[model samples]
Target: MTRPPAENQELYRFSTAERWVHRTSSTLMMVAIVTAAFLYLPMLAELVGRRRLLVTVHEWAGIALPAPLLAGIFFRSLRADLRRLNRFGPQDKGWAWRAMRYGTRAAGAAGKFNAGQKLYAALIAGATLVMMGTGLLMWFPHLSSLTWRTGATFVHDWLALLVGVLVIGHVRMAMKDPEARHGMRTGRVSPAWARREHRLWAEEEAEKQAEAESAEG
Candidate 1:
């Protein structure tokens, strides 16, 4: 069988809808984080002033954090990717073990999202839900007991710190991987990069392409 031209071989890693959803969610999360820092840090809060404004922005950002993902439910590509993120297979376990053992160097043959990416996605999702829930209680103190409100504040403060670290680490990793960053930015990646970073997913894509071509012929 004849292969397609090299120019036509770029693999689609993310769809437009997927990119938009990610961009939206990331922006909101960043806004929430920044505003939270201004609200919590005494020196920064004193310099920034406008406590009410910061609080409003932080609350709204938190409230709208899930909007993009909820809206993305209508997009088939995003839904498919969500399903992929939700599953854990044998390869995922192998990938996870290597990641734990060797840190970032353990990147090997894996699906579209390796175990680390999947774990990050899961953590972000859970953290978002927790943040929103705790945030809502704080925003409306009348909605909960004093004990509940105190507990929410404690959980919210600690989780915010954890998420800040996670986001910074995520950004640093992306900065080190230009091709992976390009895939997210442009929704496509060079076939060579895809093959090197996600061999199993690259092979699956090639198989699908071949099957489509055969049907056409």
Candidate 2:
């Protein structure tokens, strides 16, 4: 494989563990979505004719959806990313307004992850937790009241649809930026790319590098 050239000035964007976690979560989420479709879509359900198997797989997949992210908590880099995702400062709020108004061109001096990315991360994390809880309730009706189970099922179905839509949008956005995808895949991005897309993060990274070099000297 011809390796992509990352110049010396390229910045480290994601750690190997962070990439692994992202891939793992993505794969498992896809599995859960497919199995959910198989179990719920009447025509597809009839075609598949394996309700028991699909149900078991869907339940297990839902339970495992957060495993990769939970495991990532052990890594300092992942923890740092989590913290970044949780934060929404004044810059992030301003960026969000501009992004909504002007699209990608308005992605102002965002940090490692932009306000949109941060919001997506937070929404997906919350959705995952909600899905897990509702899935367990649906999987074991005996654990909850009929009313609660009914509500859980309704919430699970609707949330699954919402998540699917969000994931589609997220993928579409990723497709628009090959360098962004490359960063996720390889854990590095060109400094020029970073500066153009995430100027604040690029500046912070440069400062950190300068400090490290000074200490070494």
Candidate 3:
């Protein structure tokens, strides 16, 4: 079967650096989650039968979870994405309300990161910080009282479950949108897909394209 033309398929969405950060962070996050499961689940813990090894791996993976995001600061495109994730404008507020009422199919002029994506990012970042703090408390029990350690363990365990669920939902949504997944993988997407999913961003991209073409001419 003939593939689509290269030009038709090409719509630069993620940069190489952005994709790298995403994949690296995701891998580390998954590693931490899996190791955490082995440590937390009784049956899994017994089956694994290496508590020390699992604990060590989980600790290091949790520590490394934020490394990719910290490295992203050096990449202008990734920084831009961070900025986009931070902003919640009138359109974004509208999108949020509509999304709640009408679901993900709700139409709105979404920018590069929609309200849902922004919320998810913020939640994940917050959860990661909480996990890091609690994990550290649990790791170095001498740093705090027994009460504090117990509280930290409770928070860490619950937060891990919540993060796991959110990550699963995020993956499900991405799977439903092959173009979005392709953009992450290949650093590009279909322009048509962008226009449909992120109209405001699509318009801005179009404007940039037009300016470049005019300058070339």
Candidate 4:
């Protein structure tokens, strides 16, 4: 492949392992969502004519949703990114509030992930756990009281709907920013884009590069 121009220099953003985790998890989530539609929509379920198979696929997809992240634990880059997502600093709080009020135009200092990205990541992770728990309850109805199973079914359906909406919103946001999508797709992003979008992270990366260069010199 041809290289990016010198004027638009690209720096490594996501590591190979991080990208692998993202790709694997996203594929699994999509499979879960599609199978969920087949199972939940009466017309679709009737048309599909394989309720048992669809249920098994959906259940397994939900169960395996966390597998990518679990495997990613062995990678330092993914671990570091998880740490960044976990911490909610004052800046993140302020950015989140302003972003809510004023949208993406709101000026804010952000790290690798903006407040919105962090919030989405947290919500998706939580929703996945909820999905797994409720799915298990519904899947193994014999293990729980009928009333408990019913409640689990109710929660699982609504949670799946919410997750679908969240996924759509996330995709829309990515579509609006091709540069951001490029970073995730290729594991690199132009320095200019990084500076504009994630100034704090850009500065940190620049310092690290400088230190590495100095050590080599």
Candidate 5:
């Protein structure tokens, strides 16, 4: 038996667990990426003179970074939503094209997610996978030949660069939508925010809640 959802409430969007993981993961990734960059840059390395600590930070960050995503899988709703984002359908592609037109021509309508968002998800996932792979190799260098370790080093560094660039764009987009940050920060967003940015998701949630209530009643 299910109870009816509060008719007009802006209940929590993210759970405490989700918020903890999101903030920790984001912070660790930022630290890892930035410290890693400094380690690679000759000028910064000369100034810091702490290559050992930077490498240590990078290695540990790689270990810490995947925890949130890994833990999030236990939350079925979040995992399912992630899969939806992972798969970009025909309409998604169309949205992308329309968004390009909107940006370039400034005359057309745009859909919920533009092409760039879809591409960002793909690239981010790719970079994360690469990072995990190379990081594992780096962490357990004794298991690999010298040649493999050398190759892994290059791959790891390059993928970190890609992740950094993609994440900056993600941050910029989030800043443009103030409510988006509030959603993660407070685990809730304004009703209008959901209706405007993700009406379909909101509608689906509403219908699901309605059906559950009907069954219980």
Candidate 6:
């Protein structure tokens, strides 16, 4: 028998807490980005005056953002994501090459998470560290040398640029599949959805279930 959308199918790849954390962090980061661009970008500077307000918003937003990520550490989904995102096997390399070619289309041959997604996760992880570090240097520029401070600024700016590109890719990937978004929305995926996108995970779950059944019987 097939499970209905409302059934407890154990089809959720990301737990509720994980979704909450990601959603909170992503939303605030976007807000900060929009506010910062208006205040700091050369073209938009005139329109969004008062740099002080922009800075305050960015500062508080940053303060609010890390809380979710930290909280997510306790969630199993994040641990799985960390492993899945960083595990670059031979198949991942091939998947990534194919994804670059067929980005706007469905991957003709694909794995659970594509190469681009894995690479994007790595980029985000690295960019996140640099972005935080550079922000700290800027926040306390007097402690560093003039040259060091200038370098930090360049690093910070470049990291932002790369993060912007990745965000575009992230959005496109999500938009290409409505089920992906639905998973986020309701914290549930149809069982068929899980099996299609993450067969290995589904298999693991099945094995676990079989073990549990045998022990129970």
Name the best candidate (by TM-score). 1
Misplaced by over 4 Å in model 6 are 1-10, 103-112, 213-217
Show model 1 residue runs off by greater than 4 Å.
Answer: 1-8, 103-105
Question: In every candidate, how many clashes are there?
Answer: 0, 0, 0, 0, 2, 0
Worst 10 residues of 1 by lDDT: 1-10
Q: After superposing candidate 5 on the true structure, give the runs of residues whose Cα lies further than 4 Å from its correct spot.
A: 1-8, 103-119, 209-217
The CA root-mean-square deviation of candidate 4, after full C-alpha superposition on the true structure, stands at 3.9
Candidate 5 per-residue lDDT, tens place, 1-217, comes to 3333464676446776677777887898798878877888887778886678888888888777777878887886566556666666554545556655655123222233335665786787678778888888888989899999899989988888878888897898789887878888888866566656655455555677779677899
RMSD of each: 1.9, 4.4, 4.1, 3.9, 4.5, 3.5
Supply candidate 6's per-residue lDDT for 111: 40
Lowest summed lDDT across 10 adjacent residues in model 6 is found at: 1-10
Superior by lDDT: candidate 1 or candidate 5:
1
User: What is the alpha-carbon lDDT of model 2 when measured against the actual structure?
Assistant: 0.86
Pitting candidate 2 against candidate 6, the one with the higher lDDT is 2
lDDT of 2 by residue, 94-210 (tens): 776788789855657788889999989989999999988998898888999999999998999999999989898999999999999999999999988887898778878877877
Q: List the residue pairs that clash in candidate 2.
A: none
Q: How many steric clashes does model 2 contain?
A: 0
Listed in order, each prediction's TM-score against the native is 0.94, 0.92, 0.92, 0.92, 0.78, 0.83
Stretches > 4 Å off in candidate 3:
1-9
lDDT of 1 by residue, 112-143 (tens): 88888899999999998998999899999999
Best candidate (score: lDDT): 1
Output the better candidate (2/5) by lDDT: 2
- Kindly indicate the candidate among 1 and 2 with the higher lDDT: 1
